[model samples]
Target: MNNAPVRTVSDAKRDFYSHHTRPINSIYRRVVDELMVEMHLLSVNVDFAYDPIYALGIVTTFDRFMVGYEPEADKASIFNALCRSIHSTPEHYRGDAEAIKAAVSGMSLDDLKGQFEHLGEGGEGLRGTLAAIAHREKFKYSRPFGIGLYTLVEAVTPPEALKEKEAVETLFKDLASRLNISPDKLQKDVELYRSNMEKFAQAQEVMKDMLAADRKKREERKKAAEAVAEGITEPVAAAPEAGESADSPD
Candidate 1:
């Protein structure tokens, strides 16, 4: 048996370095997962890929705005950016414009999940990759796109185009710059909106059941009232003219 020196240097070196070392995405995923669980517990439907990303933006905005809420070193900031990128909406990129618009306009968690699944399997799509790149760059800053709850939608949108997001960021930055207010302040306003939505959804369900019950009770009461009215109108059959004439004769 011939033995080779273990220390011999060879051009073929085994580099154990993997692209994923607690990967940037893995960290973002953790943040998303935690946020989604909280949202679900709150009775909010958070099934969209974009929903979690939107949540990350809001949570990150809060973290940065609050003076002493840092989780781990600068890792919060890293994830903040990464999460935004993960959910950024494609504006007017190379993909099907109509489809992207449809997705953004009415996208739920399920739609986003489907897209994520598709992307995972079909990595060859150039537009998707480009959108992803755009998403990351756009998210690097704290400004999320759109107004109100829609802002959350824009935050998680798969980047297809940059026009709308750029426009929104420009406007948001300008407004913030003028007011000298941190974006976190907006969280309160958005939270109110979310609360309203929750209330409205609950109210809708309550009203549906309530109305049905109310109608049933009304019908039952109406039938009872009608029966009473009929009895009153029947005139008791004149008590059968009971032998009155014979009693008078006696």
Candidate 2:
């Protein structure tokens, strides 16, 4: 019987490995190595962070500023940001894997930064790479929690308006401009911190109002019970008190 050559197991394996797996894995490893080098350089030069987290050590310091280090919190943050960056690397390359691998091979951390120098103008590794850079540059790895901005807000905010985020963010943007950091550098950090701070402040206001309402309700209940025990049949809102503070809370 005449027949065409059958595609055997070996043929399938060769096809899969050559066309798909080998090239991809080779490129992937090269990109990862380059990323590691870039991360290392930035850690040392910009962040002053010494030990790479992926590298084994007794401990590693991740604080951008020597003064801002916290043993309990910032250490964990260092580990988290490192791991997050690694997980995000593939996404940074995305569909243009071959092109990105080539581009990244010769690029360093500073080169990566240059790619995204202008706002809304960025290349492959914009968010992932810049986020790592921002974490390091912001005096520690935690972006979006601006202690510097918070202090400034506290200074300018009225005692009654501490929870207001919009005013504080407006003030922060103005102050940040004075620092000369670009909007690209500040966007993720400021926006994330702004949202968290706003929600926190709003939640606090809600709590304050709830507590005040509970206290008022309890006091009224006590007064009503007392009046019922006595012979007084007066309604609770019998008449408005003269010159009562209209500014008083509900």
Candidate 3:
């Protein structure tokens, strides 16, 4: 999806409405598309700094499932208000009232994270997986401040925070492979995250560490290559005279 920056969240919402919101098609499209739209709205409206880029991508993806009126208001403070709206809004007014209600009203970063952690403590199921993906995808990761200080910097963000945000792209694919989730029916992935977060946390961390290690190695290699190039171009120090002891150990 062409989710490039569009000035403000207002523009982003407009871009989504103008483009997405279409008639439901196949079962797969229905399930995946609906789930994506719900997640996008909840993420954007959550009480935190959401990832605008991915939000745009998701809006384009699911085509504005149910959110079309909260862009003007303060996103960070509207979580409760948005939830109330979802619950109070008529069923006919939304594509899926229950889905909107659950995603919006029942979700929070703390709750989601706690649920995820609990799942791992016991035993993980589909809920665990979903919670993990939702949390990671919605929560933004901070990037480094470009100070050449790896230890002190966070490094390039949400995308780099983990291997990638699979929620929008391949997460459904992965889920489809494992479960019998109907492509046509709406999923409770957000609910799962609201209930558990451990499995997903573990999964995300594993991927994050693996990816981080890979990035570190790549940086090292790049630096090594640059050093080699510099050595070749730099003039060598003048040789000492024959009488001069280059190595005066004494």
Ranking by lDDT: 2, 1, 3
Estimate, for each residue in 91-186, the C-alpha lDDT of model 2 and write its tens digit.
222223333333444554345334435433322342343334434444433232233333323333456664555754554565445334454445
Say which prediction, candidate 1 or candidate 3, comes out ahead on TM-score.
1
- Output the lDDT of residue 148, model 1: 22
TM-score of every model versus the real structure: 0.25, 0.24, 0.23
* Top candidate when judged by lDDT against the true structure: 2
Q: Which stretches of candidate 2 lie over 4 Å from their true place?
A: 1-42, 46-145, 159-162, 184-187, 197-250
lDDT (tens digit, per residue) of candidate 3 on 182-243 = 32221243223323334544555565576678779999988878987888545566787778
Tens digit per residue, CA lDDT, model 1, 141-181: 22221222234344445445323645544444443333233
Task: Please report how far candidate 3 places residue 73 from its true position, in Å.
Answer: 22
Of 1 and 2, the candidate ahead on lDDT is 2
* Candidate structures ordered by TM-score, highest first: 1, 2, 3
- On TM-score, the candidate that comes out on top is 1
Local distance difference test values of all predictions, in order: 0.38, 0.40, 0.35
